[model samples]
Target: MNGLRVAVLSFAHEHAASYISLLHDRTDVELLTADPDFATAPADELRGRGFAARHGAAYVETYEEALAWGPDAVVICAENARHRDLVLAAAEVGAHVLCEKPLATRVEDAEAMVAACDAAGVVLMTAYPVRFSPEFATLRALVESGALGVVLGGTGTNNGKLPAGRSWFTDPELSGGGALADHVVHVADLLDALLGEEAVAVRAVTNRIVHGDDPRVRAETGGLVSITYAGGAEVTVDCSWSVPDGAPTWGGLTLQVVGTGGVVEIDPFGAHVGGVVAGGAEQAWLGLGENLDALMLEHFLGCVRTGSTPGPDGRAGLRSLRVVAAAQESVAAGGAVVRLTPSSAR
Candidate 1:
């Protein structure tokens, strides 16, 4: 009921900047900051850009010390590989956690994170801000209300240009994988929210058609993953980073849902009216709609106050990641259909 005290864990994931913006803009949230290492890529963007000190919040050197301030929750913005330890530490300190998704590079760690949170009685929420996008909300409501009749399958795309500033995104060791790892979770979580079911099987394909010029890139720049939900509904997610630097609006989601009754299409970022200023100059279509990040922060804080279940809980993240892992496995197995096991289910 009172103001929500929050701490941001890391800025390794660029989305932390957006989360910082949302938490900063909120009057009901008292924010704090902690980045374990100041010499890494995250620190360069967060500290060099002065986002860490901009709000005048107390800054700590480690996540352990950040919890000393007694925050009700902490948003873990660390890399995919770092989520487990940060989440376990936060949950150990009796703080709810809101973690950036693709919860872990490995399903085992993800399951462990959820178990730790469950053991500590702290909610572990996976950040799925795309579900918070207002336009996306309406679409989910429509499909759930049976406006689409018998649901068939949906297509989701979250393609983007190379993560120019954040090089770790293309580093398999840091981000898990290229397009398949970085991009798959968003759509998987979307399907989780919209369909209210789990993906029973997955088949994926990954390639390096783009970003071949860079020797530093070890991850594929493009990927297409097909998911088969429990109810027999199917969907394809395009999590490619194939767009050019000059593409409009970084990258946006294009979702097309098909059903026996009719079809629904959504472009969450396209509602913003913008024109091309200079194609090659970088600033393309700018979003003028309501901010999804702000809405997500508000929701997370509200859930903390009410002790409500985090909408997309850690289990939900694990589910999405199971699909991602399956996709990755499928890619490795020559695009074979990967069957997930019950023990893997949360």
Candidate 2:
């Protein structure tokens, strides 16, 4: 296989650092990064962390410069609002794109990105690492195999208290929306993956119960959204940054999928590192496995090289974005039902 040249557009997501590490360790990829404020202190901090230069990677000052390297693909890790422009640019260059979730804040922008990629005949995959998790992947396989029979309903949640450190997540305009937008997609994408369908109707309710007093926080910290898919599957998504600092590990994400034969529960929250005591003492918790960024990167590169389509494509992104828009509309309408159609289901 030929080496796949890859570049990162921004480093604000906090996951940007992880992507750097993943790219550096891969022999099949050449990593590059770019930010307009490349010389800024925070950007310098990222550079100093060995992400920008480790293994001969370059940190360019502009996204166009990064693209000038003639990459086969680019990962859009910039803030939510910057996604559409980057995706369009990459697609125009005939490069496949792996953009972070929420694709874009507006549905029209998301649709345009998809259209651009389709016109270029390049892949446009969303960064939904959860769908690639081993357990979750197995669950999807089981569902596809009909081991669980027909799925009736599912529930997904994304909950956590304030970071106790820095938080760029509270800005609604920047991060898109609050808990509903951030958390809803995971469930939405997972349900879409499991059911092999997209959500067509939704009713949502959100609130600013936490982080409201802070002048710096620009979005609500918590809320819930309910959805019904056109495929006859129902899902409820719960999320908040108000879970309390001392809440238990399991309090964060409790994903449940129910089917005719059995059910699956995925508890992805925890704070333990792996270790064991001599006697009957404490056995340290094993954290989540592998680097999802690298895994996703590998899959994307493989697809690009082999001319295959990856999961959570442009249509999936548009569908998820529509759900987010519907949830917001539902919240604005006092939890009224909103309906939409995904291109795939159309």
Candidate 3:
């Protein structure tokens, strides 16, 4: 088709900025953005028109206005709980979607979003930029090629500082859970893509001890989750918001995979030079490598134009959502094992 008309539905999530920045400069993309929820945002927070203007994208007053503009596709970056409504709205308008992660706060809502997009004959791609990392690609290649032999178990971590600008990240009602919800999905999605095996069980432990001093922080700030795949491979994920405020970067993800033949590890964000910059008050890390978000967006837009399915599609999102749901169930049961029935995994 001709140049694509795309709408960015909200700016609640931090990644929205990167996405807007990437799309704004693309000549083949006509970008429009809306954040009606911004009306109630704190005065100090950048949202709505100001955020859109800063990113050099066209702004609309509401999601309704943006959808009515007839976008061929949309990027939904709303709060976790708000994803369902935005996704249904986009699907109703027959617009392909690339939704922000943790898909939804609940499994039923995620299932509904997937079904709506399927019924509308529109693609629903989940935002999982980590899958686009070259380092991760190499890991997947090694695993697939039997260089790692039969996978036994592994340890993964997706840790970061508590989100600074967005209060919703700590609100369970808006963000789903906490560190578990915010960080688990990326590694879970990666494992799912790597193993292609159903997750048979999950056990998780979470605590609010990290930010317990803040009354507003009701959700968990630290967690450790263990998942068992159908093939008997167990993976433990430390999805915690444990990075200190003074850290040079927010945080990073790393995975150590152990198999029968050998072991492999990947640190997607490790390609960086860290030191104190000249005349700078604090330490700094200059990243080196391809931008995973740009690669992910390019893939999504390519699928949009070709009418092909996107990797980490709605079903992939649903699978990872189930893992989080199971993890929450396990947490509620005092970290007891929560077995996932095959039907539930689907």
Best by lDDT: 3
Please tell me which predicted candidate would have the highest TM-score against the true structure.
3
lDDT of model 3, residue 140: 95
User: Cα lDDT of all candidates, in order?
Assistant: 0.83, 0.76, 0.93
List the candidate 3 regions with Cα displacement exceeding 4 Å: 278-280, 343-346
lDDT of 2 by residue, 1-346 (tens): 5678988887656566677778777877877888663343233344322545653557877888988888888888776877888999999889898888888889899989989998999999988877776768778888889988888888888886664322445667667887777777767887777777777789888877687787867776777788887768888888787766544332456678899889988764443465665574655445556656667777887888987889878778878888888988888899899887656542
True-structure lDDT of candidate 1? 0.83
C-alpha TM-score for every candidate? 0.93, 0.87, 0.98
Question: Per-residue lDDT for 111 in model 3?
Answer: 90
Q: Rank the models by TM-score, top first.
A: 3, 1, 2
Of 2 and 3, the candidate ranking higher by lDDT: 3
Cα lDDT of model 1 by residue, 104-173, tens digit: 9999999999999989988888888888887788888888888898789989999888887677888899
For candidate 1, the 10 contiguous residues with the lowest summed lDDT are 42-51
Using lDDT, rank the candidates from best to worst.
Answer: 3, 1, 2
Error of 2 at 196 (Å): 1.3
